[model samples]
Target: MIELGVLFGLLAAAVLALIFVLLRRGNGSTENADGLLVEQARRLQAHNDRVSYNAASVRSSSPTTTDHYRP
Candidate 1:
């Protein structure tokens, strides 16, 4: 029972130390992150436009009528 208590106390102390270290670490600038996000958005928009254009072209070029059913 005493050994188990000592083990839990040591584990708790380690966890607290880790938390303290993480909290002490300062957050860096967001300028680079913002730039990256903006670039990603632009690329995504371009990809979407290309996809839309391809779909439109395929839809227009494909046959609309079925040979088995004639009106």
Candidate 2:
């Protein structure tokens, strides 16, 4: 029972150490967040523009009347 307790303590300490290391390494990645945001914004704008253009074309080509056999 003592050996099992020691093994569990060692495993818990190793896991905590690993988590601390990963958090420290992840702290340096905040510098590129602005660039990523700008890129994502540009992509969103382009997609919105394409959607608006398609919507306009569809609106212009659509029929205003309900009668399909008249035209």
Worst ten-residue run, lDDT, model 2? 60-69
Record all residue pairs in model 2 with backbone atoms less than 3 Å apart, i.e. clashing: none
Report lDDT per candidate: 0.80, 0.80
Question: After TM-score superposition, what is the CA distance of residue 59 in candidate 1 from its true location, in Å?
Answer: 28
Give per-residue CA lDDT, model 1, range 1-71, as digits (tens): 99999999999999999999998886755656887799899999999888777744656543554444457
Q: Per-prediction TM-score, please? A: 0.40, 0.39
Off by over 4 Å in 1: 30-71
Clashing residue pairs in candidate 1 (N, C-alpha, C atoms within 3 angstroms): none
Deviation of model 1 at 65, angstroms: 28
In terms of TM-score, the best-performing candidate is 1
lDDT of 1: 0.80
Q: Per-prediction count of colliding residue pairs?
A: 0, 0
